[model samples]
Target: MNNKSITAFTLLTATLLFSLIAHADIINTNTTGRNTFSHRLSNLYIPEAVGGETWFDDQNQYNKLDIVASGTAAYADITVAGTVVGTTAEGANIYATDNSGIGIAYELNYSTPGATSPQYAYVYPNKLTFNGSGYSLNGYMHLKYALVRLTQFVPAGPITQLPTVTVNYHNLGASGYPDLSVVTLQGISAQPQITACNINAPGSITLPPVNGNSLVEGAQGITDAPQITLTNCPGAINNIIYDFAATYYNTHSYVNGIFTTKQGDGYAKNVYIQLQDATGTGIHINSPLTLPGYTGSGNYAIPNFRIAYFIDSGTLNTVTAGKVETAIDFTVIYN
Candidate 1:
């Protein structure tokens, strides 16, 4: 080969090597052509059934969460805002790709430093339209909240507060091109926490006498003759559900597989208690039942319940009546 041609080839190889070394530092870039991109995140506030906001859901299902942008930008005057919706349709911990089911939509607006009103620039997690360039179905822009299921019961207090969680995007690459900073979800607080009731309160129940005459006369034994109510409930404790866990009871009859026992001395009767909702329908003690969310305004009301007691003539030959008492450990399910 000629000396001039060899020199040109050597120069070309050197230039190519330099270019590769410079570009090696480029990890991720939000900037494309003349336009640049950025992002901001918001906290998800899950309010309790009583009142105020909360960050935890004991039932593993959250429906009252809302998201909003922090409106604070690190580079220039950028405004980000939008709504995000979460659904159980695609199962938990999964964000939807399309705008169809449930997801939040956020918009980022880029402008001069301290600009008051800027034009909307990008629609995140949905459609990104810029400089005659449009892109859809981008999963990188979606937001997600991973709720760890609570195994144990929360302690009873005036309010139960959870620790705050910080969410970071990604670190900035070599160029120091500001990465989509980090956002934090402030702690959540549940109001009017659950507590034990007084001994003579409405939550306690005492049944009337059940004898052979009553059992022979009626087929369903007895209905909730005297309605039971949960009194001293604040307006915050709007809706509630009850679950009973009983260990020992007479085997004469079964109320949804739950037996009733006659504790203490003095002519204890072999009977059982029948628990029911206000509608007189038997509720299973194992499975949980969710009542309607609170819809009332101002102060909430005391929740009312129903139950009936009957002598299990089907199991025992004779029914002895004296002190028909039993104990049941109940769990209060708050939405």
Candidate 2:
């Protein structure tokens, strides 16, 4: 009876050891019991356009952290939790932060022998597989981040804390595997100041009267030079762009900066208003013009811009003497 009891005890011990081993296929050996990834954007220049486009930092690839899981071959489903601000064209997720008009995108790369190169995917929700034999459940897993321009970011001042995103790795319904591992994705810190500029434009511009007989076909009659000033512009802005639009009417004549005057009994006939530079060069309406070397806080006057009246080449002999008036609007763009 004693010999039989010894054999049974040995068999029971072996079964328990096997069970323990089977349940310990995956292990979390993170010394700190947590994971974090951070990125810094110093003096980041945001794009001025607001058309649902994304911009990544130059050092996005290097902005990463290592996450390690030790033990045996398994798979983990990765997910994230945060305020989703927007999405990329390729369907990647963009998370919001404390700063307005800025967002962050997360990416993950799995390093396995089966992969000829690093397999990368946006960390919205993805699965990572550990299929290599003798590979460390302890080996490092790399996670990267990038700064995406969700919209035109015009910060009020220096940027401080953005926010954090919670990333989770779970092995649900998988027998003997760890349930979950959490990683916190930190927001980018930056010091970029974007200032708002005001356009000081003339409400109306009036030209001097001209003799009707002196106005020949295609000849300019009267002219006025108006200055459009930009005020409260900050030095942080590299340059400024501006364009003009006709507010009164839409006609093919706008291509030559010509507009029809207000219709009335005394309104000018066979004569139209034109806009031109001081050098008499015709100004293309709705075309963007960049202000060169515009960097500072001061008043900037639009150079060489003027308006004039010209005889309608279409009606050469029927020029009438009357009022010639029109309105124009201008828009300023900067970053």
Candidate 3:
């Protein structure tokens, strides 16, 4: 070999021998299978490392794990693991990701700094979010906590937190799904948020909570609508806002699936008064509510409707009472 080559080889051998003497604790390394990095990388500072390759040396000290897939949509979790050498310390588990679980690294880091003493295993939470549905990475990753399915926690049978879609109105069919008639739901004070179909939460997409309310104009004989309670409910107590007039209507008819009152008939329109709390005078029932029966059809032909010709009469001013009150009951027809 040339003199320069021989000299360079001698220098490299000398450096390796010196390193072995200095850091005798350095462990061996290997190219573990996909996502698995079992090598003990020698400690070092990484300027700008990328993924899809092994960045560890032998000691597993400071390894730069650059994990990536062929395309942005290829879901894969960039997982790393570290095991403590002896019994004095506890084991730690940390993970990070994007979409299905991919993460980024800032400077080279092999474990959580000063988190667990004598960290038995290494891997910290460095998860990120991704743009799904035909969208490439485009460099969008939100730091988030990915929920690990509760299989490791909960008991067998099954536990579920139910979120409900409810509508409280008047004249709901005795025991069937609710309906939204013209006495109907215009818009909820909190629609987008309060309308949920499943439970775990509106993941990825969320529902906005319904808060305040304003009235809509719909006096047609069609009876499915919301009950508007007028007033700003604060601490407690209540006050009557409006008294409704319901004595004028004779009778109404539900044609096909709609509530239609005969023109100039005696069908009435009145508000139901209930002591929502204990604020109103002489409100004896705490939870007793005034429900108007629908006699405008079949069995409903009897009472047709109550609370008609009803007056606020100031009897609804308790913690249970509010201002002006009205209700619309119907069914949610699923086509």
**Candidate with maximal TM-score:** 2
Clashes of each: 6, 5, 57
For residues 280-301, could you state the per-residue lDDT of candidate 3 as single tens digits? 1222221123323311111111
lDDT over C-alpha atoms for residue 86 of model 3: 19
TM-score of every candidate: 0.37, 0.45, 0.16
Q: Model 3 misses residue 280 by how many Å?
A: 10
In model 1, state the lDDT of residue 19.
38
Tell me how candidate 1 scores on lDDT.
Answer: 0.34
With a 3 Å backbone cut-off (N, CA, C), the pairs that clash in candidate 1 are: 83-104, 83-105, 84-104, 85-103, 85-104, 235-300
Residue 84, model 3: lDDT of 17
Question: Cα lDDT for residue 104, model 3?
Answer: 16
Tens-place lDDT per residue, model 1, 160-270, is: 222222222222234354444323223233232333221222445666555555554112444443333343332223355555566555333334534567666784555
Write candidate 2's Cα lDDT for 1-335 as tens digits. 55554444444444444433322224342331364655555434443454343344424322222233334444544556567888766566777755555565665555443421225555466456543333333343445545555544333333455546444444334435455565555655444435457777778877877876667766365466667778756433456788777787553375677666676798877677787877777778888888765744456778867777777666867777778777777888764
Clashes of 3: 57
Which pairs of residues clash in candidate 2, taking residues 3 or more apart in a chain or in different chains?
A: 69-137, 70-137, 70-138, 71-137, 98-162
Root-mean-square deviation per candidate: 17.3, 13.8, 26.6
| Count of clashes in candidate 2 | 5
Model 3 residue runs over 4 Å out of place are: 1-123, 127-142, 147-335
